[model samples]
Target: TELQSAQRKAAWADVARRIAHEIKNPLTPIQLSAERLKRKYLKQIDTDPETFATCTDTIVRQVEDIRRMVNEFSDFARMPNPVLAREDLRGLVSAALVLQRTAFPTIIFTAELPEDPVIVQCDGGQIGRALTNLLKNAVEAIEARKGNDLPPGRITTHIVRTEQHTTAHITDNGKGLPVENRDRLTEPYMTTRVKGTGLGLAIVKKIMEDHGGALVLEDAAGEGARASLVFAQGNGRAGA
Candidate 1:
C-alpha cells in the first residue's frame, strides 16, 4: 500500500511537470503583447485617454497575475531535494515574520523562539518559503474579515522541540478553515479567495514532503487557523 501511494505521488508529479511546462511556454509572449499594447496605445487614443489607459492597465495587470500563477505551478512541478544543513530555526522564523510585518503593517506579529538555537537539518530557503506562505495566508484571512467589528489582527509563531520531533506552529486570529472541505485545502486549485490560485498550500505541502516533514492544518483554540510544520528527529538522516 505504501508503495502504491508512492507511485501515485510520482505519477502526479510527472503530470504536474508536463502541464506546467506546456502552460508556461506561451505566458511570456502574452505578457509582452500586453505590455506592448499599453505602451503603443497609451498616447494614441487622444479622445478618451483615461478609458484607454484603464483598459490597457487591466490587461497588463491580469497578464502579470497569470505569469505569477505560472511561476507557482513551475515551482511545484520542479521542486528540488532539500539541501540539508544544521541551521537555527529561530532565525528563519524571525526572517519570515520581518518580511510579513513590512507587508502587513496593521497586523501584530509575534514569535516565541527558544533562547538556545533549535538546530534542524533543513533546506533553509524552502523552509523559509513555507513560512512566508503561511504568514501570507494568515494575513489574507484577516483581510477577508474587513469591515466587521473585530479586534486587531494578530499572528503568532511558536516553535516546540521534543525528543522525537520538532514543530512550528503558526496561528492567526482570522477566519478559520471551513469544516467541510478542510482536508482538501492543500490540493491544487482549491481556494476560498477570489484572487488566489490555490497553489500556495499545495507547494508548501510538497516542500515539507521533500524534507521528510509534514504540513498540518487546524482551527485555533478560540478562533482563526493554526498551521504546523512538523519534522521528525533523527541522527542526521538526510531526506531523499
Candidate 2:
C-alpha cells in the first residue's frame, strides 16, 4: 500500500512538472495574442455576443486561465531551476491583464506604476503565474460578490521600488478574506472555493522565496484584500 502510494504520487508529480514546463514556453504568446484580439475586437465581433468572435474570445481567455493555473500544478510537481532574467515588472503586469481582461469586463482593472521601468531578476514564467493567480483570485472575489446588494468591484495592482526591494501588490474590491482563512490561504489544499486545488498561492510563495522574495497577505483597507510580493532589488536590463 505504502509503495503504491509513494510511487503513484512521485509519478504524478513528475508528469505534472514536465507538463507545466513544456507548455509554459508557448503559453505567453498565445495568451497575449488572444488578449489583444479580445480587448480590441470583443466589441467588434458583436455584443458579448455569444457570437463566433465573442465566443471564441471568451473561450480563449478561459483556456488561458486554466493554462496559467495548470502551469502552477506543473510547477508543484517538478520545478525548473531559476531561469533568472532581467524583467520589467510593469510589462509582466500588463501582460497579465491582457491575458485576463475578458474574465472581468465589468470589474475595473487599475494600475499604479512608475514612469521608469522597474526591473527584477526572476523567472518570467513563474512570476507571471504568480501575478496571474493574484489577478484571477481578485476576479473570482469580484464574481462571488456579484448579487443584488453588492456593486461591481475593482482590482488594483502596483509596483513600488524601495531602497532595497521591489514590491508588486495586488488588491481587490470584494468580500474580504475572513480572518480565519488569512493564515491558511497559502497552505496547500486550503481554500474556501468548492473547486480549487489550493496550489496557486502556494506556488506563488515558493516562486517568491526561490528568487529572494516574499509574499504577503493583508486585509485591504475598504472591503477586499491585498497581496504583495517583495523581491530583492537587482540590476536589470532597462526594458522588458
Candidate 3:
C-alpha cells in the first residue's frame, strides 16, 4: 500500500512539473496582450466601453490567477530538500503566529507555547512556511463560516513534546473537516475551497516528510479542524 502511494505521488509530481512548464510560458504573453488591447481600444469603444473594459480586465485577472496556480505547481514539483539544524520550535511558531495575527486582526489567535525552549532538528524556513500555510487555511475556513450565526473566529496554537517527538497543533473554529476523503486531502489537486490551488497541503506534507516528520489533519474537539506538525525527535538527514 505504501509503495502504491509513493508511486502515485511520483506520477503526480511528474505531471505537475510538465503542466507548470507548458502553461507558464503563454501566461505572460496573454496578459500583456490583454493589457495592450485595453490600452489601445478602451478609449475608442463608444458603443459599450464598460463591457470591453470588463472583458479585458477579466482576461488579465484570470491570467494572473493561472500564473499563480502554475507557480504553485512548480513549487510542489521542485520542493527543496530541508537543511535541517537544531532550532527553537517555540520561536518558529511564535513568529508564524504573529504573522497570521497581524494579517487577520479580527480572528482571535492564541498561542500556548511552553516556557522552556523546545528545540528540534528542522529547516526553520520550511517549518515557518508550513505554519503559515495552515494558519492561512484556518483563516479561510473561518471566513467561510461567517454569517452562519457562528461565534467569533478563533485560532489556537499549542505545542506538545513527547519522549520521541514534538508536535505543534493549530486549531481553529471554522468549518470542520470534510465529511469524506479526509485522508487523501494531502494529495495534489485535492481541496474543498473553490479557489484553492490544492497544492498547499501537498507542499506542507512534503516538507514534513523531508524533515522526517508528518503532517496530521483532524477535527478539532468542538468545531473546525486541527492540523498538527509532528517532528521526530533527534532526526538527522532525511531518510537517514
Candidate 4:
C-alpha cells in the first residue's frame, strides 16, 4: 500500500512539473506580444480601431483562458493526498448539488439522498472536487447539445450503498458519450469540446483511484451521460 501510494505521488508530481514548465514557457511571451501589438498598432492603424481592439482583446482573453487552464493542471498535478475520515456521503452530495444549482440556474438539479446517512471513509475535499467536476461536465454536455427541440437540461445525483461498495451516480440529460473511444474519456487531454482542456475527467479519475475507487462513464438509457464514482466498502462500515 505504501509503495503504491508513493508511486502515485511521484507520478503526479512529475506530471505537474512537466506541464507547468511546458505551458508557462510560452504564455509570458504570448501575453507580452499581444500587449505590444496593442500599444504599437492602436494609434498607428489607419483602419478601424474597433477591429484592432477586438483582435487584441481576443488574443488577451484566450491567453487568460489558457493561463487558467494551466492553473488547473498545476492543481491536479499537485493534488494533496486525501485525508481519509468517516464522512456523510449524503451531506457531501447535497453540498455539491447546492453549489451546482447556483452556478447553473437554468439546468434542473435534483438529488436522491437516503434518509439515513451513507457514511464512507473518504477524503471529503477530494471527493467534493470530483463531484463538482462531474457536475460541471454534465452542464457543459447539456449546453453543447445542438437543436431547437431539445428538452430542458436536467441533472440528478443519487447514492447507492451495497455490502461491498458505495456508489454515487451523477446523471445528466445531455448529449451522451461518443460512440468511439468512450473509455478514453477519462484519459488526460481527451476532450470532445472545442474549448475544453480535457483535464477535468482525468483529475476526477485520479481522485477516485487514489481513494481506492473507480470512475465509470456511460451513456444514459437512450440519451445523456451517467458518471459513477465507486468506492469500496472497506471494513463494511460505510452506511452503518
Separately for all candidates shown, the number of backbone clashes (residues 3 or more apart, or on different chains) is 0, 0, 0, 0
Ranked by lDDT, the better of candidates 1 and 3 is: 3
lDDT of each residue in 1-240, candidate 2, tens digit only:
999998888888887777777777777777677777667766666444456566667767777777857755776766555698888889999899887777668888989989997888788988898899889888887787745867668899998887878998999987778677778899876788765778878888888888878999888997899999898765353553
**TM-score: the better of candidates 2 and 3:** 3
Please, what is the TM-score per model?
0.80, 0.71, 0.77, 0.78
Better of 3 and 4 by TM-score: 4
Candidate 2 wrong stretches, greater than 4 Å = 1-12, 15-72, 235-240
lDDT of each: 0.86, 0.80, 0.89, 0.88
Output the lDDT of residue 202, model 2. 87
* Clashing pairs for predicted structure model 4, backbone only: none
Compared with the true structure, what per-residue lDDT tens digits does model 3 show for residues 32-70?
A: 999999999899989999999999999999998888878
lDDT of 4 by residue, 40-125 (tens): 98998887988998998898889888887887688678777888888888988989998999989999999988899887888899
lDDT of 1: 0.86
Best candidate per lDDT, number? Answer: 3
197-218 in candidate 1: lDDT tens per residue?
8989998998889888899999
In terms of lDDT, which candidate is stronger, 1 or 4? 4
Q: How well does candidate 4 match the true structure in TM-score terms?
A: 0.78
